[model samples]
Target: MRRIAVLLPLLAIGVLAGCGGSSSSTAKPVVKVSGAFGQPPTIKIPAEKAGGSLTVKTLIHGTGPVLQRTDAFVGNYAIYIWSGTSHRLAQSSFTAHRPTLFAGQLLPGLETALIGQKMGSRVLAVIPPKDGFGTSGNPQAGVKPTDTLVFVVDMMKDFKANASATGTAESNGGKGLPTVTAVNGAAPTIKMPTSKPPATLVTRTLIKGSGPAVTKGQMVVAQYVGAIWSTGKVFDASWNRHQPFNFTIGATPTQVIAGWDKGLLGQTVGSRVMLVVPPADGYGKSGSPQAGIKGTDTLVFVVDVLGAFST
Candidate 1:
């Protein structure tokens, strides 16, 4: 768990004055500004008064509105600190608790930017060190005395008003199995058993490497190939030509379908497993068109558990 300490002292205070208490008694501060990604610093300003362009270079697949605290939002995220050519710090989707930012639990800049964002909105906020960790920087963050941060946040869900229901789905019950039905070195076909205790048991110890076995709350990096079981139509695959998908097992909650969660449980690290995920555990009735999956689709996946990280 990466602890993002709240450093309010360094935050610039932008105050706004309004009319007398004849009608309204409170005075709200309003600040505004703008810029592009990777640009040099022109001046230091308070978060409430700060503003800028997102200038998205790559908008990964997402669904919904930009997340905002005012409107209520909750989800997992990945953060990375970047220096010229290297990443200073990085944290992937390792959240077990659906952090709630209702009032003031986040940085001023983040809170201001995230408020009003709709559900499923993925955003890339280019934050200067000033609006972020400030000059002294976050010692705990390993952020150097001088470093800018880039946060690639994926808003998986928003349950500002309703937390209990979403929270329950996020902490999936712990009991599932990895099923293998096909094999192809880098990408294999897999299936997740449906029976409440998973009646089917298929295992393949392909090219075993020494490491810890896959655990419940660990992060795993994997390459996979998925297709509809009935028609053998390819749906989604990371082995084609893209970065391997990374996820903290049981951390994403409903980010992945039930079938995927059940299929990946209890697999050893560095081993390839195939799974057959039924529609009930998959996308259900709302199949993804982009992936060519239908309501009654049965998914076949080949998962290569490249690595696992424990906290």
Candidate 2:
């Protein structure tokens, strides 16, 4: 794990503050960042130390949605610790081949730099101690209380908690599967029948999306509801939490259940899919007792594919 990942946790939430000092007399720091959007940037720190305040510079302007305090976004970013005459690279989501989710509260300087920026823009932020990890610094990340931090962020995609599938409905022909009632921008309702659940896995597309088909090894954002077929009781739902689930599809060792890996592949973004998962592809014979699922019970799920990003 990257050192910053250990300290920041990516989706941290906290107070929001604007870039730069509160006083007009404060001068903007001279930090140079040069690179193409979507690639790692080359940063050159000034020989002189920066002012005792946050500084923000937009390296590239994007035309996408303007981000808000409560909005969420995917970004390819790199962090460097600037120690006056020298700097050290701390972390880079671009190098890891995975974009990061920036939402809720972040490092005050980071949030300030990103909040008003447009999606697809590249932003650079120089964060002083007060706007970063505070006076305690992040010793584990080699950051001293006196050191300033630099961030280069490439905003890739923006999304909201209520994001859902958008596409034309496809008829299922009443194939004896569970029925699903989905409304755009709202949580879906699913009803199961008393008939015996399918013994094998069943993948059905309830809505055909216009976006690209999902590929293996891509970061996927989705909203879903899972229920036991036998009892028709809801066991889990991302909608209830008001946050979409993010996972790397087909990642080694797996980031989700086997059924999800099998069912989501090839599904297009914005499509709503239904998967009837048998034990072998689900929680297996052990089942998920905490979720009210039995050893032999089958699982039914309706999932909305919100977004997909290549690693």
Candidate 3:
């Protein structure tokens, strides 16, 4: 989970009631949140004692799908701890210009606040110590045992584990590129070209998605198959695991290989893109022996962008 800038350790939470209503039967604080959906919010915390129970308020209702605890989602958040008159900021995916992947990896309180909520909504939750770090306050984030945690979240996108790409198919312009065979929403098989591989990185879109264009510092969920160009052997395939792959698209040293960072940028969500990666953008001189990749082997990947989420 890489922490992903959270108030507590990255983890999952349990499910709650249905969406479209605030939680009752709990004594909550008076926290004000003002912001548009999908944008950074201005949260005003009361300079008073903590709340007695978990409290959830939906600032802006969304028209998207209702989220479930089993589903994976992406959203931007701002966290703070309230103790007496001192309110301090802990972490914010909004400030980082990136969204966190809420794949059941989050604090229990925060997770409970999100489940059953609709995508594209703005939620404010005030969690007491019971649902937060409990009796042992999180010293790493400077929280006291009695301190209450406040979270402002902007829900962006949600997807099931088996979600696939949906877009308009386009001609692959098959000139010097490998042939891809995709059927029945399964993994696409790649047949290498007889000619030599390209010396540099090459990206071709087999499907042009109408969704938002993928940008840097965004979490991208996709289904992909990676093969060595020369032997045409599949080194990796997300479809085989029956789960989509997710990573933060960024510079080479960050979440994924350099080839993915460069080739996937600006690609629209739901597009099936083919990437021809040279050695420099791959594992470099020290190839991945475990994956049977050599230093000079050019790699080929067929990627289906399922979704993209940003701050």
RMSD of each: 17.5, 4.2, 5.2
lDDT of 2 by residue, 1-311 (tens): 00011225322312232233321122555878898999878888777777887788788999999987766788888888888777787778878887866655577777767888998799988888777877776665677888888888999888887889888899542468999986778888888876798889999999989999999999888889898888889988878876677788888767788889999999999999999999988888887777777879898888899899999
Candidate 3 lDDT over residue span 260-288, tens digit each: 98899999987999999999998888878
- Of models 1 and 3, which has the larger lDDT? 3
Among all candidates shown, the one with the greatest lDDT: 2
The Cα local distance difference test for each model comes to 0.45, 0.79, 0.76
**TM-score on alpha carbons, each prediction:** 0.41, 0.85, 0.76
lDDT of 3 at 179: 87
Residue pairs with backbone overlap in model 2 = 13-105
Ranking by lDDT: 2, 3, 1
Worst 10 contiguous positions by lDDT, candidate 3? 11-20
Q: How well does candidate 2 match the true structure in TM-score terms?
A: 0.85
Candidate 3: pairs in clash: 11-105, 11-106, 12-106
